[model samples]
Target: MPAEADPASIDAGAALADRGHGHRNEGLAKLAVGAIGIVFGDIGTSPIYAFRETFAGHHQLTPDGLHIYGVLSLVFWSMMLVVSIKYVTIIMRADNKGEGGSLALLALINRVSGNKRWTAPIVLLGVFATALFYGDSMITPAISVLSAVEGITTVEKDFAPFVLPLAMGILAGLFAIQSRGTEKVGQLFGPIMLVYFVTIAVLGIVHIAADPGILIALNPWYAIQFFLSDGLTAFLALGSVVLAVTGAEALYADMGHFGRNPIRVSWLFFVLPALMLNYLGQGAMILSLTPADAAVAIQNPFFLLAPESLRLPLVILATLATVIASQAVISGAFSVTQQAIQLGFMPRLRITHTSASAAGQIYIPVMNWGLMVMVMVLVLSFQTSSNLAAAYGIAVTGAMLIDTCLLAVVLFNLWKWNRFAAMAMLGIFFAIDFAYFGANLTKVPDGGWFPLMIGLIAFTLLTTWAKGRQLMMARMREAAMPISIFVDSAANSATRVPGTAVFMTSSPDGVPHALLHNLKHNKVLHERVILLTVKIADEPFVEQETRCKLEDLGQGFHRLIIRYGFMQEPDVPEALKRLTGCGPAFKMMDTSFFLARQTLLPSSRPGMAIWREKLFAWMLRNAESAMEFFRLPTNRVVELGSQVEI
Candidate 1:
């Protein structure tokens, strides 16, 4: 067979293989660049404040060699272990159909668990983790921009008075442009961040060349000595040290945007090395100075690395980099909110797709403005990055701790790994997460209370919405008439119209309230009646072939179920067009979309507190219209309103 091989076949096979390899390489390169811009932004901007905060923060320490070496060692190992090993290597592998994040992981866990009794608590943990993410989303922009703008003070002492106003201005501008979309601006992010990382790496290398002793911080012994000698002081420094790895979760959260391999490659090769080098450079610079000079230099170590002539340019670059960082968090908040809405944990918000080619690039106006207001308030209140730093770590640490708990469940229950191995991994992650969380707790009296308060408020809103929705659905079902019963009773008697009526319902098996109201008020039914139910599955994406399922209930009635994953937005009309075996192709002008608008009347319900019910009512009242969220044609839509008490 080998001797008789056809020449044409051999050449074609070789060409195909070469093309495949080339395409793969190109795809990987593109993704790596994109991941560098989006996934690494928050952590990339950390060099602006992380090193300085450790030595000159709320719990300031003398910049002696031991203290400098110890803090650097802690920062280095924290990146290596917490970010590289725990998140990039381990947690990223536990993705749901190539999607990563707390909610995605929770959905995966729920799917695998088959609805066990313990699943409720696991789901709550994930929901709370998602809520805490909002707090992180708010704080990240405030602190990152403030820290970057604070660099101006180092350029010239007279610029100190402009710090807060400049930071607020930058943040306001960043949020202002969010609605117009970021597709254009986002293209430059990868290249800008690439330049930023390389510049920081070069700066670090130049400083490290002068004092090579800073390399000792790579050893574990320095961190050990730090804890052994300083006791409570060393432990407390962790509150600031945690800042170095703040955006590490973005690596996993944004994995769905970029694949695993690209993110891993970017982190190991570029991002990690640049960060460690910069931290070490800052440490080395501090060590070369006398105690008095080091104390002043530590106030803004990152900017001080540049020559006096270049400090102004460095500030400009830092400001741009911080804006990029803030953009990632804002975009992430939009993504997570969309997911929550689909998963039924939050109310629907207006979502605008900015890029037709990219599904992930979306804008939410309400979230954007709300975040901006909160961020500006934080900037004006804190007045400096150091004070804002105290509020940073709590939400991040809480989310990370929840991720560890969810990961343990994934390993032992889903992956079916060895129990001891899973427990061992869990123990290590729990120890680190608990320590960081505990350390940040000490800052509550200063400013840590801010994120904690945000987390609590967010958690309450999320859980209340979920519970209220469930109770409302149960009440609706109790009041619902069966579709079969309706079809049989009314098909022969009701007046038949010429067109199609698509009634949107949450429950597939019941007659929609809008349908009932239509029959009651109009005394007529369409010749072709479609009871449509949109469902969100526990996966990130649903295949097109399986998206719409049509069931013939007979007597001119058809049940259509449109399925979407949590990561997808539902388009009812688009799904309707794909439907087969219906009377004809769905024409927008010929079809009427029917929707039920519920007016919630808070009652003494066993499900939620009365105040929470009122809050749910308020949220329900403000939710985006179904016509808009489902992308239905405006003229073809009809809304039926009814009051429901739970």
Candidate 2:
């Protein structure tokens, strides 16, 4: 040995390490509990409708021992393979700096690959996955809430008429409460869900004890046997079976909120066990009944698992769980919208930070109201959870297939995993994803057309906005004069003014149009002129120390580039407050912010269709103002209008 270790120091170091480990374990346990409430809500609530739909849905399956066992086996294995292995184990590892989602994963791959020939298609796949998620988001709330409320009919038939209105009212209330931050309400989620999980588990265990034989469905052979026996029917049943694993994507998407270990711990140890037990319990109850009773029981097997005295309370508990599940999906929508905006795939909508402590806790009023309206319409149109179930699987399966495609890219390209192992995993994922997607295709005429339509519309809007922004930036860049040239001429020609002026632009290399407009109209240059560009990087967060960058130009001119990660909100005033190396400190009252509002003109351009160009124009016109998005001092801001063609 180079030197003898000090025994006391070694003991001290070991004690410190132990303390750190203890703290880490405690944190993980707390986060895992939180993850159970939020991350697993969607999938957790699936047992409410998933089993019922497989039998009572559009493609009705017989609730006999064979079919029941087969379905149960399929559900269990799907949870194991899709949710546990694919998402919890493999896909969660692909997080972008602890952030997980299609956009984050896409950014990670883009940054690593660096303009490979195949990256363009991968990007499109990721965008389409995001698009599909929107459709899924809309359906999730409608179906989840509707299914739970439908349980009221099982308790009392006269409560049936109130189902639609009651569900609608509950949804409206849920949406209405979103303006207030969820941080306070989020605290209770874990405890309430903990109770719910325990209650459901107890109900499952009671039924499981009645006939421990139901445990046989846990075997994969039963699943394969059903496919072998009833090939086409089994294939079509997958359309409904896929609903069991509907929220698997949410696990990976929400990894940033809760760390990978917490989510994994929650799912593998608590959520998965509880869900499988409940599903198995449902199958057991059906098996214990006669054909006639089983037929009626299958219509509402999950609630029937509880005794007559407790059915109503069971319904209430389930409704609460469904509400929590819907809340999680709604929050996910807001998060996704924020990511899309920062990633430049969407227009900047007004975003309200709801919680002072939790930066990620935000409320998007437009998205909330829009989703509310859409969900109300869906509830009104579909009228029943079974009917709504028909529209559900396509978007989810499509998104899953897209995720598999993305995962394939991650495996082969980014991780450079062993070729054989990667292919084997991908082969299984693609097969399952494609089979589910193909089965859901049969649902198109029944109601699957809705999500496809939504996905198409969302895809068109997203792509149009992205392409239009790119073209607009290019046009602006082409027209802009070099900053060095502008500084050389304007510094001496213009009369110097007293205060600082910050001209906002998309590009760092050129003079901003607002600056040009300010010069022409005001006929003066500020003593301290800052040309500012806010850049969103291909990451989730930029450390504060490296965030602000300043470059000095001659004659009191400076170019400021503030880099923000895709998940971060751009706040110019706050950023400027912390900025150093820029000659003088910025004062809100003394600094004037300049922004250019671009009005797009429809041009016969090769870039996009005229219709898409018009759509892009509408989106641009409706986007949140730069002043608001950048959190500038409103009183000291100037807006200049310019017409541009792409």
Candidate 3:
């Protein structure tokens, strides 16, 4: 809900500054609706496989008596505690500009923790958790779609082989339309999800009617009995039950898009109850089924729970719902990567916006393509939806653990909440999330490689970005001119020009790459050569007055620092506008933003090991343009090429 100035003007000044438009109400409504598409999609569509897998997957819990009731009870309470209470009721309220996610939580922590050593690992964990979310995003579509399509085989055994290819075709078609804005496709998500909820509820209620006693199974005792009765196998079943709440984190992630109230209302009033009912109904079905038909029963639990006549249409609805869930996660991946790059955890890549109204919904072409390839490979490799379940739970549980760690910091330091409150919340969630995460560890051998692989690659990229940034800063500091020398030498000799030539730089010590290279190549300097370095402070956004630290380095080269929080990107011209009143009126007419483009000399420097050196070079090649980074005008911008090994 960025303020509607001219889009062109906004982009020219700063990428995403909180210019919330007059459409607060409109945006809120749209955000709520779109959130259903993105945030709750995975969790909303969970009934498709969660129960089915718990009773049938590798853990091999048979559908019988207390096992059936106990598992259903567990799923119900898990959704209530994990999704509805924990996230929707509590966490979603803690939004940063209507945005809720790990980053938002981390931002809150940084504001609170100040100078603690915990900050570094907290940030790394947040970034890694986000990386894991991407892996889940890619896998969700493959598994969900594959599961829904596989329902076809139960209705008609001959159609079994076509499920994977059909799922692939649908996925291919789904991604093919990314260039088209979400406005059109997104409209269907709300009403379709609404119908989806009603249908699953109705289907489940029909079964629940036959056995009203099934409702009694919702108690914690049944859940405890299931744990006591079944032991490790039942405890391990949490890996699959946890799947039901997989996309619950999205509720927070898409908070900015929908706002807190809508998501809260939607999940609490509608989505939660419907999911629980459907899950309970699945349990009831197992209670009625004979042991011999148990394998057949778990294979298609939702369909089997319903009258045989209603199976096909139910399958269709489930498929659509699952597809929508997948769509949300994929979009989430794009958003997180964008945030990572802006905050310096990742290399910047092309971010293409398809919609004018929704700045949040962007298409990262590389991310989209990368996900599609991995998802397709997952579908082809895993084949069955049950196999993909192992990969799914571990990533989600890992993210949940990270969230708890960050929340502990938030409660204790950030919010300054009491130790008891912090400990109580952390202990409860930690125990729940950690147990499931530990349980999911067993999934590693059976197709869990998917999330692990994606997380490792993503973690590597993020760490490399940090290391590269350090190397760049170190190199700049080494080559920098001492302020005493620069003032003594250039202060009296240089000619003063008309306007500011803001040299976006890495360090304040030496002459900036742009300043040195501009003088070397063009033999000209502006009236004010402002050396600007935007440092991402621990907090979310920098305060206005503290935004810039200006030093008179004389010779018209003002060594300047534009400080920003990881949540804020510095706007050079806007920053210059504020700095103007300090001395003279600095107009845009004569001002230019100069940037230094460092093309790595395929190197033999003492900077890094050979492999890392090559990795940095590869990353640099794929990175977004410096002009774009500095928010510089294309016409007046100058990029002077320099060589750096690290």
Candidate 4:
């Protein structure tokens, strides 16, 4: 027999494996707890207004047993089908290298699709979905905080006058604290949300016990009976029922932060059960009341779930949860903006890293202030969460529909799932998405116009920026000299200075504009010349060992390409330090970085409309400079300006 393994060694090996597996499970548990705090806050807070709005909203309905059970049935099945099956089970699996979002997913699909005929349309859909998110971001904070503060009126009728001012003050404070980072505040999120979810679940259990018949709504027939009994009213009620699942997309968008299993665990085991329990209790409470009493209670069913003594405390807790919900959406806006800039869909803006330890903790000043102003305007204009509710579902439903479209591409093209199985699944998604979107369209005259207007404006800006950047790059490439010719001619003709000169270019194959300009003006070349190009890959991150691609073009000229992920911020100086084989080590004092500043001269070219061209030029002018964005030293930088028409 071959030499047998030592018994003690084998036992030790098995014990080590067991220890490693235990650690992984422990880590996943911790992440799941954290996900309950951050990822579920948006949907968790929906119970505060979702059920009440369905009966007392713009198209009000009577709170009779038929309507009550039917609406509850719709809410439960909607979450199970939309939030549970579609997002948690299926879409979460389409993560791009463990990252998920509209832009992240688009990049992944674009890379895999190659140059197929359908690629361009798919990109437009992704960009439009991102644009619609800006509208959603502005409305979330406005409506969440407003609904929470309005609970004060439920506590004391006299407190009604102060609601608007108090809500505005709290919102101002929340936005004010954004520049100071949220790492410390973020630590308390999980525990507080856990308490909120448990409290709501207990409140539901108490009411649900009193009228257990309300649990019969869990059957799907009640939902079908709802539509068949009153088709038109039920169709319009969809606009409001959709609110219960408003933040369902957060599960997929935030999957990168906390992995799929943890978010799934938080939803399946903790968050979803708590949300449905509260909805059921709300329905049960209405059914147990007299007609006149139900009418008054339906005005604020969420707070009335508690006894008189506890309502005030519950109001405070709900307000805090709403604030936390607002914070998550605001931070999401910053992340999406960063991704847009890196992928060339938008111009660069200043990004400040709030935490030294966490790369994802970023603050964008422009986005923060802009959102604050729009939110304040909305709160003032709408005056009540009921009114804001009319403006909400359009953006959310539109994005959901677009996501379904993108999922079609993923199923048939990327994953190559079974055709019949995929089609059946997609059919359910499309039908649900269309019903909600169509219902929301009926509210356009009553405040739904707000998000649609915002979406249209945002989509125009996003598409214009993307098209302008593409045209500008193509024009520059057409005029660029071949790198091989430039190296041979410049190496023999110019004076060789002592230090290294690094010229930044967008393309790896062409000679940079700054290099040509420096040659004509300065009449000298450094001994070590580097043509550096930074390429952002179609993924969330690139490994360190594969980041730098160095090619020596002979005659002391080297072409360096540094690859980064869309989620990463580019630090040119730091990346250069890790690079070797191009020559001597880089030193800040000795090395000079040359950048080209392009001034757009918009002409009647066959590219974009005159109006869009003007808008693109204005955007380019206001963009943050490359030196700050790339983390370059101010002292050792030279900028050469050139004019280009697109």
Candidate 5:
């Protein structure tokens, strides 16, 4: 009754299906492993300090049964609610063409909102969130590595003096290796983290077996009873409990690097289980000790989970794990900075691609060194991980709050969720975020000001650069001459040369100032004149087919618009090679690229304050040359300077 297919066709269809399944399996495996190394590293390393600091930190808590149970419950719920449900399940879906992070999310929201009055406030929130990330970037490396190295004190009292110097050396070495890139380093991260996670889980299980009653902390009633019984003490404990989810934002930020599925799988299957087991195990271990011994154990329960003989080995493993954690945030900083530059929020800086196969693997010298110096200063200033803990939670909590706000926008405007449902979800997230933020605010006198100060400075710089560029573009457009008018007036009268000339401009319809200056001073035009404009899109990567658009203005004059995503670096030479039907084929040696270099003269402009204007002038003066930023052939490029007052 059924029609039989041809044997060859059936075999081919089965083979094709097999190959498709095989590729999907292989891709998923690779992404999951990679996600372990980078996406989960920060949160993975949190157990080292999160448990220890909750009892012995600046806001010290008594190591009684109620307190221990309550704290463990908070940690569990925080990870489940803030990281698992919110980021992994919800916020990650708000990606901008597969890219995630505050900037990418902002671009997505901005694109969907069109031109609403609320857009500006939303943009400011995103910018401030980005500014706070720099502070987190600097502090994560310092605090994580320091906490790992401090494990030495638990091994032997004599090693106490060596903690600071050893941490500094390890951190210094970590920063030193960044210039060489992370391809080789990244290979070891996944395997090492796997071992670390399994080891911690085993450690937790060993102790949990001794005090099976500790498992009761998994019940939400413990957390509720905690708030009811303890009042203000429990309220303030939220700050220390917040550490359990510090690197949660990295889950969303790194979605583009490894897709949503792998990250979610890795977290749900491996990372989350290991973390909960370890925190629960530490709580169980403390419960088994006598009051005096429990007090001593509370000071460094993470490292003490091991036998005396294995302590040193555990410290070594932890140090490696923390280094991997630091690497994740460092790489994130480079990615975010690149996005900002592409999005026109910052001035151009030197960026080097480390892996030819992976465009996302990059090294930025200025950002790397700047982070290293600040990290070192934090180590010296805080002097201990316990002290640094005071400064940690504020930035993370602030970013989390901002993310919730942005997610509300996406839910209402993009996802078209019911208004009541969206608001209900937002209300839950806001309450938790606000509670944690308020708890951290109490830490300002005890070193929390560090992140706040850094945030303020970064926010000022980011806003100033964005506003300055906007004003400069407006001023340039006022003086810009239409390309049609320029060509009609001078096409025949100007003497012609033999080679090709490419003029880079912000406005596609206008002749570039560099072109006007070149024609005025040299009194000659090239045989093939191309007016080129590079536009950055809201997405991460544009397809090759739609990358370039060409127009023939007649009489050997052409207009070309090349588009790139905010996550990409523009290469003028490579883009030109893809252009067709635009006069002659491009040869690097035969083509000369023309760029305009503006010299800012600060005036009493209505746009920005005098100080900000001066600051913008300094930043503009120090920005990398366009030839280098665009990856143009340096020898075949010409820069024409002009003065602009804004």
Candidate 6:
């Protein structure tokens, strides 16, 4: 779970210039736009559920005017305190390299701890949280689209017949677009999300002006009253309510792309306030309306609160906003899975590149299909947006709780911030988030089993993949011919073909998986066989003066290991450029990057049990490929695919 994030180098321009682009500010801006835009979708759509579920989720509060006031009060303060204060204001600064996510946080902890003692438990928890996140990703679009489309049912009772299918169709369309990278589509996300906020705020304001007095739900008393009156139910209600603020984790995850500032400004100045005002307005309407009108109002509460003439346009705006929310969650799943694979928590798979310039833009065909299938099943099985809401928050709330724990480590252990100050701030966050987490627990039996089951399956797969890699690595090391011996032997017998072939490896002392596979399959060896391993030193960028070490073995076989800092991409080409003067002159056009492609096959050996083998295999088949992973040139890259039973 604690994957090393290759922190973004401040000298991204230097790397880009070598690659071709002279100035990278354009690419950087595009990256910022797409990444931040795609990331905000899930959290952006919370208003759809946050307020509605607070008043109507599993532990349904009375639709009475007073309860609505209390619920809205809880929702507004929760956003202000939990989403704005805890995350956007304070936690966004806790970034590793430029990368943000649970795994990134885990890496930061490892850097601070300076030991492997916390690795096992912390990593397991992070991977499980990531797996659960996929469940959230799948369900987000389903519920958002369903909830918005169900608006038709409010206008026409017969529209209920087509709501579920229509929602499924929209979800299917959304997933289908995964084959197309978000670079083009993502350009519109920020502005669109901005519009979504404005549209919802305007709708809320129209209602609030009609009944402005209900704005007093801003009082802390109503929020307290709800908890006192509903007792445990109010606490349980907090889980679904917290869904309004679901994207706080993504805010951290995408910090590197947006450089932490734009997102902070966007959330604090625009997104947060708009969301709160809308929720407050919803509360105001709910509090003023009679109980007899409760069912009717909530049926299209968001629209019902609006004037009759503007209702149709509001529906269109809501639908577009819902689409953006769904899209963002889907993209986050891709980024997280990529990190998981790199960290050794997941197996290898066929990841494809959809865009040329945007390295972050990738498409995983298997994952896309898998998500589509799950979303379809969820829609078909649940049969209603409200039912799907039951299962939605547990994974999201659980993730938020995990983030808090990770933040605690960052503040005290990493930053060495004062414990008294850190603990005081974190304690308030812990209480509020845990309360929401407890609220989500009430939803488990109702419909929350889905994410838990997915998390368990995912956790098992992740654990198995990690353990299997460890055992298999030990086996490979044991079976590997020592560098001195293999070179001595191959120096005499192996055919020396033209040009250089660098086999990037995990360990330079042992023979690479790709070298062995190439020699076995094609029965050809490059004239110069360079076994290269990139070691990460604890710095931002490794200096050229001491970037690499080259050992000249007998004949054409040589061993090279490049050392980098925490904040640099593993540019095989760049590393090759630095390796030229050390004895073997590497020519870019003439050289081929031989990469080992492991097709995971779960074996009943010391690595992974049979059940876990299936999970690892499934994960491998769904994972992104090594092509884009190592930033190798497509034509010059040769993949030696081999099977490893985990």
lDDT of every predicted structure (CA atoms): 0.89, 0.89, 0.75, 0.90, 0.90, 0.72
Deviation of model 4 at 494, angstroms: 1.0
Residue-wise lDDT of candidate 2 within 70-152, one digit each (tens)? 99999998888898999888898887766788988999888777888898989998999999888999999999999999999
TM-score of 1: 0.95
Candidates 2 and 6 compared by TM-score, better number: 2
Single out the weakest 10-residue window by summed lDDT for candidate 6. 13-22
Answer with 3 or 5, whichever has the higher lDDT: 5
* TM-score for all models, in order of appearance: 0.95, 0.96, 0.88, 0.96, 0.96, 0.86
lDDT tens readout by residue for model 4, 93-169: 77776778889889988877777889899999999999999999999999999999999888899999899999999
The alpha-carbon lDDT assigned to residue 198 of candidate 4 equals: 97
Q: Candidate 4 deviates by what RMSD?
A: 5.7
* Tens-digit per-residue lDDT, 218-330, candidate 1: 99899999999999999999999999999989988888777777888899999999988998888888889998898889989999999999999999998999999999999
Residue 113 shift from truth in candidate 1, angstroms: 1.2
Q: Is candidate 1 or candidate 6 better by TM-score?
A: 1
Clashing pairs in 4: none
Candidate ranking (lDDT, best to worst): 4, 5, 2, 1, 3, 6
lDDT of 6 by residue, 490-546 (tens): 666777788888887776567888888787777778887788877665433456888
Q: How many steric overlaps are in each model, in order?
A: 0, 0, 10, 0, 0, 5
Winner on TM-score (4 vs 6): 4
User: What C-alpha lDDT does candidate 6 achieve relative to the native structure?
Assistant: 0.72
Off by over 4 Å in 5: 1-25
